[model samples]
Target: MAVISNSLQIKHGLSLWCPQSASINRTHRRSSIGLGRVLRRSYVAASSAFANENREFVIVGGGNAAGYAARTFVEHGMADGRLCIVSKEAYAPYERPALTKAYLFPLDKKPARLPGFHTCVGSGGERQTADWYKEKGIEMFYEDPVTSIDIEKQTLTTNSGKQLKYGSLIIATGCTASRFPEKIGGNLPGVHYIRDVADANLLVSSLERAWKVVIVGGGYIGMEVAAAAVGWKLDTTIIFPENHLLQRLFTPSLSRRYEELYQENGVKFLKGASIKNLEAGSDGRVTAVKLEDGSNIEADTVIIGIGAKPAVSPFESVGLNTSVGGIQVDGQFRTSIPGIFAVGDVAAFPLKMYDRIARVEHVDHARRSAQHCIKALLSAQTHTYDYLPYFYSRVFEYEGSPRKIWWQFFGDNVGETIEIGDFDPKIATFWIESGKLKGVLVESGSTEDFQLLPKLARSQPFVDKAKLQNASSVEEALDIARASLTS
Candidate 1:
């Protein structure tokens, strides 16, 4: 709530808002030892008098990871005035994925709203609202983000000039949405970017009055917004530098299928486009998008969804994984500093299943890593973090569409791809390397079919490309992949 001159502008909850592939770096694995000895120091340490009140567990972010971490602490019988959450937003942590998904749906669709989509609920757990934290004895510091973190002394100072020390610290500060420099009208009134509930609220206000919507990225944010814009009956156009959408994940064929679907729903596309600058009207709001090719698209609202990077400014002195763009942590989410931990998009931890260090930007990793970190901290879990990359989205429900526009992908999207299905009722894409299934993506899959991808991808089953490609339906193809795990 207090604005200060000496504070880092590290945005919170951006990952849970955007939840896209911001940056992914695969590196050598790491080893962790002596965690128990270090964490046993407790809140009553040598520097106990540094702060008026020291919490045993202080989570620096109130995003999905922070909210879930609080729930995990309460579940483990640890929330007896020993846990606290410091957040940059006035509201407590809620499910951020809704900002682009159900939150953007047409008003008639009864889109998701606050108090109903808080953390843990996104993962089928209990909803932990603001009052829930009070009921469970968890301290809440809303709208006060920690600006400075002292790793050696194990203390952090908030922007409101509040000093707090922690026995065990969680640096869950998620990410910040990437934006254009203000020289190019990036700061124009109608040129918007969504990274939290506040950002979404402003965008919703713009949408209510806008006649045309211009989305300036092909990734998750642009695609999802495009779908929502069409639903609202606005003139929607998606412009991106890539030849196809979701360039990071979708195969050419896979991208084509979704592009066709979007086209059928009245969304326009200007693929492989480069933006020169945003043109502002006399009223000082974004009015048009100028392209490098001497073309201009008139627009009343612009949504920027280029990408995001980890919000790790306050803790950079603690030796982060610079190559991976986040705080470096071991499998147990322990930073180089003994009593500190990092989770969610900000922690570049070892992905044991892949034998490489990766910083995953997704809700699933956020929920699982928070629970795993707390368990490891409480001495209930011993194993390292073994995570398989998973991403999924469901968009578009127009007047005549009965088919569910949904897809789930598991594992890495490397290696040669095999695009299957008829695209009429189903579409499946498999990534194969050395005749083994490395990843699987399927649209309009069944409940049973969706369950097989994680299993098949983790096992990396040796598969026959011909057998999989020739399978009749999504169920049949996934059935073949499921069998290959044992064969």
Candidate 2:
């Protein structure tokens, strides 16, 4: 099996999320592994025996999209043993976000584990365990990832030499972490990345043995893991080239709020810093992180969370949205090639609300796009992917925290930002563009409170500038926006 260089290849069993400008604004997204030598060995032994098998529906990814699509298939009564899922991971699709959040909680907290966090559960549905797949008569090939495809023949081959001809295919292979090249010690022992459950498991072991921790790149992975590191009482420091955290989304004031919380919780920041290389100890474990400025920070564990890239290596015939780094798909998630639909983080579909083709690298989109694609496949009506771009996180949810920080955003962040709340019990930020509400971000809000934000973002309601200008509280602001909608 050939390798895709310079990325953390968990060979993601589906290794996915949705598209967000190739790297999900430098990764609220990532994971995927390349087919490896061991799998290739199995190909020789199994190729002849498993050759020329066929399935009516084949999902090439075992990530969020695959799991939700499987559920949809079951719902639509189409998964009658004719549907199959091929995954690189050993387990069925569980909630991938748990790998970043609860999976990293201190061992004493008894963090989340497989079977508990499986797909659909994250969004309040049935827990689809491996047994569920079997009971539903859904064929699953674990640790046997599809390695190559023949578009003309409508067949795909797996690493274990299973040949599968599909009447229709869904590409859900997600994305892989963008890492520092090995030339600079990116692959050092103490250095870690989180793209899959396997990657998180490795990082957990490293975190246990670690004291001083250095996290590179302050994207989703960086921020989330740093909180985990701080929770473990390790000396944690996050260094990034950006001036503040979540540069692509958070306004300075908003960033300051979260940064303050992290600092109060013992996470340090070294903003505007660039990485030179990682220095490893004699035992071949990383010991320190060196910056381009010739300064070095001593460390026991180093995690890289720069960004992610889509895993579309095997399907060259599928058209690509080169601008965003994904398989190009229409509103219905139909790819450039017929019968091969792409969803989850791998499909760059038209964002109807934004009137542009964009890829989302988030779980919500992965689940929604997959369901919509399956519905489109089964139905004759033309359907469009109308997704409200959203991103969110909650850090330090474990016990003994000064405060637990959580936030959720809806719609685009491309405009002027207005903020409310003081980041004590809560905070809300709104972005208005072209005299309409374009985006909303809220921290620590109730379910009912959150319901309004997505609506405001979607409707793009005209603003009452003076009313908003005088608004002092989130409720006041909400009322103002509500009145604007009615007006």
Candidate 3:
């Protein structure tokens, strides 16, 4: 490799490095090029470009977690000076959840846009935009991914050949969507995965002419995309290896409810089946799907929402402690390497409430954990992160019956029995273990229900079946349940 020093300007910041000059001394400071005398000068005072390259806080990845952490740093008066966010994406952090929801809608549907769904806003806070970053003196290295990191050296090198040294580092690289192997026709055209805005845009663009669409893996992404497909008046078919949709999380009864609704909306389901290979047309686009059982189904478009894997390639040589899912972190979001922290879907942290390690892949966890990590770094607080796991989904218009469902759930669902509430306009399911509440799931609940149900679930109050059965409302039921625990 050729060795040369050149001044490379970092976007939205200062020069990433000192200019190549023989006059520069070992300290990278300026020295007079003369045989008679030598004068020394600081790089910051000599070069305007050199002052911008170094960062006090360097965060990898520009997703929700990184965005929130930056916002937290700013909120706590760390806004100016050396804060740099290196991201592979061209744009800064936005609402990634929108990629599957409103973003896939038709043009007339008025979908979400940048600066609208920015970080902190997703958590009901202020929107931090490019202008905000410029005003706050934060540097963003967009479209330039950090290719290597050396914890011992306290530095990282980006793909653009720019080296950034950090006093503190935060790893929030997030996750990547898993695609089928190329040998199995995954490389064929008309196949897509929705992980970023570009992916969503491609899928949405294809929907204009795609009438028959086959969706593989019936997880949340698949189910949500299926809803969007149905709205587009396409013939949608969802295939998965599981017996029911979200089989790992939703109970059979709840799964049936969602499955029935989808079926009623003209969506086809192929459960307990696996894709053998994709059949392609002469144009090198997927034309049909072949099942392992030797069955074939015609398809104009294919979507694989199998799952996501943490983007941890850069850390392979770094030797940070990582689990199969993500980087293993303590309650405070600190990884095995001190001064280096991990958050969001890329972090597998110990769940204090459950006393088990959990790597949650959800928006709520991402936002909270990012803040937690920053708070710990700032205050040096030793408080364990006690966060309640929460997840939700939004689906609208099923079978033209004006179907709309907004559901939220808290805690683990494993239990000996379940208590079901009225399943009409509102549905609630409580998981009970040893006569104590372990989890709560409520759909279309009243304001009071959202406010109290989680507290009740967290407290794990003992339940009185007679009182709970007689209670008419969620609040009333919770009150009666709490009384039993206290009494």
lDDT of 1 by residue, 308-397 (tens): 878998889866665557887777887766577889988877777666667778888888899899888875476878987888887775
In order, the Cα lDDT scores of the candidates are 0.79, 0.79, 0.73
TM-score on alpha carbons, each prediction: 0.90, 0.89, 0.86
Off by over 4 Å in 2: 1-52
lDDT of 3 by residue, 17-37 (tens): 111111112222122332323
Stretches of candidate 1 off by over 4 Å are: 1-42, 45-51, 397-403
- For model 3 the TM-score comes to 0.86
**Which of 2 and 3 is ahead in lDDT?**
2
Where's the lowest-lDDT run of ten residues in candidate 1?
15-24
Residue 355 CA displacement from its true place in model 2, Å: 0.8
**Better TM-score candidate (2, 3):** 2
How large is the C-alpha RMSD of every model relative to the true structure?
A: 7.1, 8.9, 11.3
Worst 10 residues of 3 by lDDT: 1-10
Residue 262 displacement (Å), model 2: 1.0
Error of 1 at 170 (Å): 0.3
Per candidate, the number of residue pairs that clash is: 0, 14, 1
